[model samples]
Target chain A: MRTAEALRMAVEALRVNRLRSMLTMLGVIIGVLSVVILVAIGTGAKNAVEKEIAGLGSNIILVVPGQVGLGAAPTQSRLDLSDVAYVRRVVGDPSKVTVAVNSGEPVRVGRVEVFATLTGTDENMPHVFDRPLRRGRYLTGTDVDTRRRVVILGSEVAAKLFGDVDPIGRQVTIAGVRFRVIGVYETVGSTFGVARDQEVHLPVTTAQRLIGLPRINGIAVGASGPDEIEPLRQRVVAALAARYPDETFSAVTQTQLLGTIGTVLGMLTGVLAAIAGISLLVGGVGVSNIMLVSVRERTKEIGLRKALGARGRDILGQFLIEAVLLTTIGGVIGILTGVGGALLIQAVSPVPASITWWSIVLAFGVSAAVGVFFGVAPARRAARLDPVVALRTD
Target chain B: MSHDERAGRRDDERAEASAEPGAAGAPAFEAIGLTRSYRLDGGVQVDALRGADLRIGQGEFAAIVGPSGSGKSTLMHLLGCLDRPTSGTLLVNGVDVATLDDARLADLRNRTIGFVFQSFHLLPRTSALDNVALPLVYRGAPRAVRRERARAALEAVGLGHRLTHRPSQMSGGEQQRVAIARALVGDPRVLLADEPTGNLDSRNGEEVMGLLERLNEGGVAVVLVTHDADVAARARRQIRVRDGRIERDT
Candidate 1:
């Protein structure tokens, strides 16, 4: 049969049973919709993590003290001061290292006293973290050497302490020791649940003296280029391994952390998508069932045509085309609904969601394949009918 | 001329026409010792067509008349290339049907035979024009040519004004006329109709019989299978079958 005639007949068949056809297509719609929405959510999470990772300088590495073994309780062992000095000397770059000791202390300004995390480091710390002073100068090496009692407050801490007044030359008390506020840094939003703009900073010697610590707790390192990070980490780990033979210390690269997070998120997305794929399988089965019923209903028609000289392939093509058209239309609707659903969620919730072009193409292709795959048995049945018996049937 | 002489002269002319194609004058159809049997539920073999020998010449209008279950329908099916005889050398238009594959048989049917069923067998959703155009479509005629030929066939059947009507919307007589148009559209060598007027009233039946008479007059070989003696009386010749065998030919 000609393509035009086949298509016309298929369309007529679908029109004659509109309600049943629509009901059959519903399964496909739900299946494609679920796949699209699930994939969109997965894509959104990946984007959010990537953005967060980008916010923290891609080359930045954190070397925290104490080996928190995988699934073990957290332990605190102060970093050796000599080790920090040795790292600075071995790296031959004073501008890249930020040796810092953090103390959780309560500081009072006027009437309100807020508990804030205080880190003491030299001026290079801000550059290493990609953080710059917004108002006044950052803490200097001179302050660190003299153990000056001058403090630099974060944007949020400054706001809580002085409200509308300039805190550049104000006085604050940390653990009952009076300190003069030198400057306030600009806001840096939350990363990994820790808000950078909510902390206070002082000179390294000042924090050590005030907190009664002989050595810093950790050191933050920054490489000049992202390509150098892994090599630098290896070098640092080897150096630390030699110096701290008794205490186990490790160096982790930013790439390793990013990879770990990506793997975890990818696994989660795969699980959700697999559950959604089951609906698609059910939809395919529904299509097969509908096609089987259609073949049964049109048995006489098939017989008549065959007796009139229609080839078996012609009949098969007609039914297959009908099935494919139905599923393709269903796929298009499902894609639109899935994208719309994702947009609705993004509009109402904090969770970000997005639809990718690949998802649309993939869903449509799968649905079409499902239609053809399921349509084969019925088409074959129709083709194999005996014309004489069929013509005799009422 | 006398009736016998006239018949003899026509037979000679038919023989001469058949001789021009090949040394062996090909019979339009030939069944030699054809037999068919069906095994009933009780393990008894019931013969549908047994040792049936028949031959039909080209451009011959013949009728096969019988009561129900007399195997006339089975003979029609075998003659129309719609079924394979269980055991026989059944040849249609010089080709042995038993040796031909399914596809070749379908091709032969499309090229050499057209059938009109008793129930009119029109696709319910199709327009009269589309129903008539179907045979041409199977023949792979171009769309414009198919439409023109279908229109001409509908006009031939006097259904030009009802081209847009579907089978359900049309009267029984009109639907049968459309079926006739569909059968004629392919210009087959033989037109096989089974109980062409079975579903119509007497007046409509007469009209259909008149149409068949007019087609036969145009030199198209027409075969009608009917139990109605009055319907069979209109034919120039009739063959009566009883219990899977031809009881009379006149």
Candidate 2:
């Protein structure tokens, strides 16, 4: 028979047993659904991490003072401002280094107060950490050298103390020393939910003199570019060892800080996909089982068709097409469900999920392939049925 | 029947007559020294048909009558190309069917012969139109053409108004008529029916027998298998079998 006619017949036959066909397709449905949900989440989280890493390149590194043991935490100030030159000397690149000191205490601005993290950084702070100023001037080299009293507020801190008014030239007191507000950092929010938007930045020496933080706490080192991070880190570490001679320190890069989340999500997606594949296998077996039962139920019908001039190949084509058609329908349902489920997740929670067209195509392809693979034996059995005996079946 | 219906049947007969080589006097189907045997569960062998010789001509209504185990069904099977002979050859529509492969034999059966079983094996839950058009479906005919032909065949069998009726909704005689329509939709040269009226009451059985007679009268050969004396008497010729071979042919 013509293939079009055979396909129509297969569809009609499946429609005659709609409930059974749907039950048989359930396994494929669940398999495709899980694959979509898990893979979408995996790809979405990976993209989110990559976007974060793009905003901050691999060249950004943080150096902490001494490695503290037990419950004691080593303060970043133990790494002094002198280490900036030491780093520039050994790395042979002064422009590629950014050094900073820090302290945090609630400072009053005419009775309006907010508990804010206070940072002491210099001219290169804006460029090194990629934080841009919303208005006015940043801390200049002259400001740090003269120990001038100037401070910059984060967007959140400015909004809290000044309430939308311009804060430049206004004074906020810290430990009884008045400093004029020079600039506010642009709204960069937070990294992984740490509140960077509530910080107050001051000149390194001013913070030392006013806040009683006498020396630099930490040095942030920048490579020439992202590609130079590892080599620069090695040279800086050797320089630090040469200077301190006995104290141990810690250096961390952007990649090491964010890779773990992506790794865990990726492994989770892979493991879940394998489990879904096993469920799909079970669904395939369900299709095979139902097809075998259909063959048995329609034995006399098969015999009649055979006697009416249908060949073995014709019978085989009928059953195989029926199996594939049902599974493809299941696959389409699965794609829609996965997309909807992902959108629902993105709406309610922080877990990321993304569905792509290629994944849909692959899921459909796998389900259809499973249908055919499992459908072979049953179809073959039906095709090889004895016309005489099949007619005698019912 | 309408004149157009008679003309259509005659046109098919004329077409078949011209297509078949040396078909003027040749039997529509023939079997010479045919034998079929198979082993039982315990390796005991049984012969269903042994060296049975038969010939059927165009437009001949021939009946084979025998007791329950007399091998008449085996003879019908061999003649219809549903099974092969073990040691002898059978010719169908002037071709040696035994020498042909499985696919060609299927094609020959599709185009050259139609079968009506004792049980009227119409597919349940399908319309009579679909059931009747099944043979043409096997022939891969276009949908409209197959439907038209099947409709004509159903009308010829006097079931024109029952086109959409499913088999379960039809009476025994009507279902048998639908089966006969399915058989004739391909316009095969021979009709092989196994106890076509066996399951119906006397009234319906006679009606089905009359339908077969009319089809045979329309220039298609008919071969009927039955043990009923009255059913066998309707045919112009009868072959009686006993002990795996023909006991008499008259």
Candidate 3:
């Protein structure tokens, strides 16, 4: 039989049981919807993280005191202020490099107390970290030379400690020592759940003296250009390796960090897509079950058609086309629903959702495949039925 | 040449050879010792047809009259090419059925035969026109051509006005006419009908028999299966079957 006639016949058959057809299509609809929405959300989150990483200033490199990856335990860093100076000498620019020692500390202003991350660094903080003070001045070289008990408050810390009161030139206590808040850095929004606006900065020498720890946790270097970032990192790692042969340093460029995070997020998206695909499989089974029932119910019809001179392949084509038509329609509905759901989630919630073109294509392809895969057995069953037996079935 | 053209040529040669001086060409069906047996559950075999021989020619109105389990229906089925004989030779349109594969048999049936069942066998949800057009669909006829032929057939059966009506919406007589239209739409050389009027009242039965007689007079062979002697008496030929064998032919 011709394809057009077969399709028309299938449409007529399905129309006879409209409610049953719609109900059977529900499985595939939900399956494709979940796959599209879940993959969109995963892709959206990955994009958000990637954007944040890119915004953390260009030509930047991080040097941490650990040999990460391969399930190895991170070693404690013995890197100190001199190593920072050594890196500066290797780069031939003192202002282009800095060291950060992070520790959580409680700051007191009158009776108000706020827990904040305390970072100790040098005068090059603005240049290296892209951090500019909103008021007052950053810690100068004179402050570090004299080990002055001066401090800089992050925007959030400044607001929390001295709300409606100018925090600059005000006294705050840290670890029982009186310090003057010299500056308040401009707001830098949070990323990966770490609030960058809840920090307090002081001189590296003063933090070492106050915390009783002379070792720096990590080093931050700013290169002249993107091309120089990797070379600068290699030189730093080599110089550090030469000085402390027993210590392992993990040097990474910002791009490298972004790439690793991107890979992890991509896998996460793939896993979510796979989990959602199970529903599609179940939907296909529903299609198969319904097709088998339809074939059985139409045994007399099959016999009549065969008696009218329809070939076995004609019967098979009719049923198979019906099955595929059912799934493809469901798949289209699902794609529309998923796109709407993703858009709704993106608009209504903080959870990000980005619909990738490939996900749409994949979802549609799989739904159609579900039809063909599940359709074959029932179509074959219909084709293989003997006209004599089928006609006798009443 | 294509297989169909070659088959047609062979058919012509066989018809020329079988014609006896001034006889009307080849017979529509020729069976010799035809037999069909079925194995029931647990291997109990039943012979549906026990070595029966028959011959039917084109444009002849014939009736096979028998009671239930008499194998008249089996003979009709074999004649329609819906079932194959287990033994012996059966030729349809001058081609040995045993030599044809399933597809070839289907093609032959499509080109040369039509069937009508007792229950009307019209597609329940389809319009009369589409149901009549169904046989042509398997023939790969275009939509316009199928509709035109189906309309002509329905008009011939006195159902041209009810073209769009479904089987469920029509009465038994009208539905039977629709089945007749479907069977006649293909312009088959032979029409095999199993108890064509079994489900209808006397008036409707008379109407169906009259339609079949008219179709046969128009040079389309009509073969009807019935148990009623009154119905069988209307045919030009009567074939009585009993116990899987032909008991009488008049």
- Best lDDT goes to which candidate? 3
Q: Which docking category, incorrect, acceptable, medium or high, applies to candidate 3?
A: medium
Worst 10 contiguous positions by lDDT, candidate 1 chain A? A66-75
Error of 1 at A285 (Å): 0.5
For B61-171, candidate 2 gives per-residue lDDT tens digits of 999999998999988988988888888878786788866876777777888889999999998888999999998887666677788999999999899999999999999
lDDT over C-alpha atoms for residue B235 of model 3: 93
- Weakest ten-residue segment in model 3 chain A by summed lDDT: A68-77
Candidate 3, residue B164: the lDDT equals 95
Off by over 4 Å in 2: A57-83, A89-96, A99-123, A132-268, B1-25, B39-45
Q: What lDDT tens digits, residue by residue, belong to model 3 across residues B1-250?
A: 4436644664674466346332346788889999999999989999999988889998889999999999999999999888988998988867788988877777767767888889988888789999999988887777777899999999999998999999999999999999999998877889999999899999999999999989898998889899988989999999999999999989
Which residue pairs collide, candidate 3? none
In model 1, how large is the Cα lDDT of residue A311?
80
In each prediction, how many residue pairs overlap at the backbone (N, C-alpha, C within less than 3 A)? Answer: 0, 2, 0
* Model 2 Cα lDDT, one tens digit per residue, A100-136: 6666689789998788888888877765677778987
- Model 2 chain B: which ten-residue window has the lowest total lDDT? B1-10
List candidate 1 segments past 4 Å from native.
Answer: A64-78, A99-122, A132-218, A246-249, B1-25, B38-46
Ranking by DockQ: 3, 2, 1
